[model samples]
Target: MSTLVAERQLVADACRVLAARGLADGFLGHVSLRVDDERLLVRCRGPQERGLRWTTPEDVHLVTLDGEPGDDGELGEWAPPNELPLHAEVLRTRPEVSAVVHAHPPAVVTADLAGLAVRPVVGAFDMPGTKLAAGGVPVYPRGVLVRDRRLAAEMVAAMGNRPVVLLRGHGLTSAGASVPEAVLHALSVDRLARLELAVVSAGGTLVDLPAEDMAELPDLGAGFNHATAWRHELANLP
Candidate 1:
């Protein structure tokens, strides 16, 4: 397959993984990748509109960072997600980010509303996840549909240089260097949220991992953290 074809497949597969992992519901949520400085491969809604669970390559289309269709100038009846701007502005500003995953994991929303922030609370449960939480996750304090440039820009500004942003009363947006890494970030955060919920619901308190243990977490590199983990996600997909 050509590079474009590969990227489209990646986006579609990521969408399925999101739904399979319970991060998205119905036709909500999206996955996108920067194709170049000017264009990107994103999951658009086909005429069938079967939702993210049924996403396939045909559901993925090419659009510019400015939200225009590909060089073909048309995508027929297919329409990009209403939150296209959420993906566009991020790609426009973050040169280091090649992929973006926006998801609506229910536990994450609950955790945020209950004032449970995402912190490095576990030590050996997950290594990469622990490191990611240590870096801090910012929250975009709005639940509005980010369908315009101005709103999208605001979300990006709130996200800053962090790997993820918790959309208050809405969903979460996670960024990474590839399709798998981005999805993994969302998965890790969702796990943390679920744990927080379980702990709090059982009359426990949220606590961060000891500084000494956090300092000992190793940098396992992308090989094990992204590539290998991605294969596992794909393998587990129903």
Candidate 2:
């Protein structure tokens, strides 16, 4: 298959994984892949539905680095996420990035409101099959919308080479060379966020992960492990 065609499927499949985990929540989050150096294929924003197992490549839209929806709009004629600005902005600023995944997982969002932060826990929060947010995922100070260019720039600056950025009072933003890699970063961010919550809950402090542990963290998947997480969320779906 062409790179573009494969990218569309990858993007769609990634969304299903997020929906299954209750991450996307209808239309709350978005996932995008850089099919070209200057363009991205992302989920079109429409109805906010969950448990998406039927998304097709047609559901993906090709957009520019400047956030302009592509010409052949019919590929996924649907409107892209309002946060497309954020995605496009990141891709423009970070040339190393090829995919971006933004999600509002409850645990991570709750941790943010609780004044919690993600820090290096195992050698910089590295885990097996997980893309540890190197340099740590810094939570943006509150009050900045995802589309705010200044805020997005600051977040990118903080992210540096790490794969994720935590937006205070909002959610998580992760980037990878491929869509799957980006998804891996997102999943790892959630896991680390959960770990931080657990540590604080037990009256423990979140200390930085030693360099050794950071080097040991695994790269499980590019946030593609939705089936496992989806099954767990089945009982909690409201």
Candidate 3:
């Protein structure tokens, strides 16, 4: 109905999509939507709520860029993720970013640990992979959890102008102007990571697309294929 309501629903849906796609594992990831220049709505989970697979709109909490609750007394028993600084600082610094997703996809973490580069091997068969290589995904090179501003600031610095950043042996952080865009980027990163690992494991030599070829691929404009993915995952939600 309202813009805020829509954004909140988007954030919730993004979490479900993350769970459905296996990008998140048992309460280990978070998604946030920028409500404005000063505030954002992020998925908050208590100890009892152990997974993102069943997250609903009620699980979404509103907090300021400084990581303060929208209504101090309203949060009640809900607690924001410890990595709030990751979302807060990114949204604060990147005005163009309206959504952020921090996820621990196994494929991504594995690839990083093996020192494998996620390249554009499949071309158009994988839109997200193509886009990632085109944009030059950066790695944060830190294996620790981003629980404070200093670490978060380092992550943001490593991210620079990139939409996605690999957190060494940790995970990944994806940002976009919308929930769909961010979610899709996260999914794409995982897909690319998986593909890279598969190739290496199979003893196949990996060949990346040339810079000129990468430029020829179309951008993932707007939400790209996120809407289609959302519908498919939503339909299958338990």
Candidate 4:
């Protein structure tokens, strides 16, 4: 397969993994892979498609940074997510970002609703979670659907240089240099949210890992163990 074809498959697999991992609800979430500085491959809702859990390469579509479909006109009757601006604006602003994921994981949404923030209380047991805490995951503080350029720009401003941004009571948006990296970040955020809720339910006060202790941890950077995590998630697909 060509590079575009391969990237399309990656986006499709990411959609499946997102739904299987409970980070996505039916056709609610969307994943996109930057094809170039000007365009990206994204999952669009097909006329007959029911959910992202079973998304295939055909479900993926190519669109410009401005959310216009490519010349191939392959989208047909399918329509990109209303949040296309979410992906478009981020890719346009962040040169290092090549993949973006937007999903509504229940744990994350609930954590935001309860005013619980994800922190580094679990040590190194969860590398992504630990990294997220150290790097600082910002919350957008808004619960509305990002449907317009203005809303997306607001989210982009809130996200700043962070890899992940939590949309209060709505969902999350994660960006990375590759599809797996973006997916992993989304998964990490959900896990961290779930961990936070578990601690609170047990009546335990969250004590973030000391800054000194966090400073001692190694920097694994983005896309850490992406291949392994992607393979594990794909293996679990039915």
Clash count list over all predictions:
0, 21, 0, 0
List the global CA lDDT of all models. 0.90, 0.69, 0.83, 0.87
Instruction: Give the higher-TM-score candidate: 1 or 2.
Output: 1
Ranking by TM-score: 1, 4, 3, 2
lDDT score for candidate 4 against the true structure: 0.87
- By TM-score, how accurate is candidate 2? 0.76
Give the lDDT of residue 64 in candidate 2.
74
Better of 1 and 4 by lDDT: 1
lDDT of 3 by residue, 89-160 (tens): 999889999999999899999988998876777777776657676678899988988989999999999999
> Considering TM-score, which of the candidate structures 1 and 4 is the better prediction for this target?
1
* Displacement of the residue 214 alpha carbon in candidate 4, Å: 2.2
Q: Each prediction's TM-score against the native?
A: 0.97, 0.76, 0.91, 0.94
What order do candidates take by lDDT, descending? 1, 4, 3, 2
| Model 4 pairs in collision | none
Could you give me the TM-score of model 3 versus the true structure?
0.91
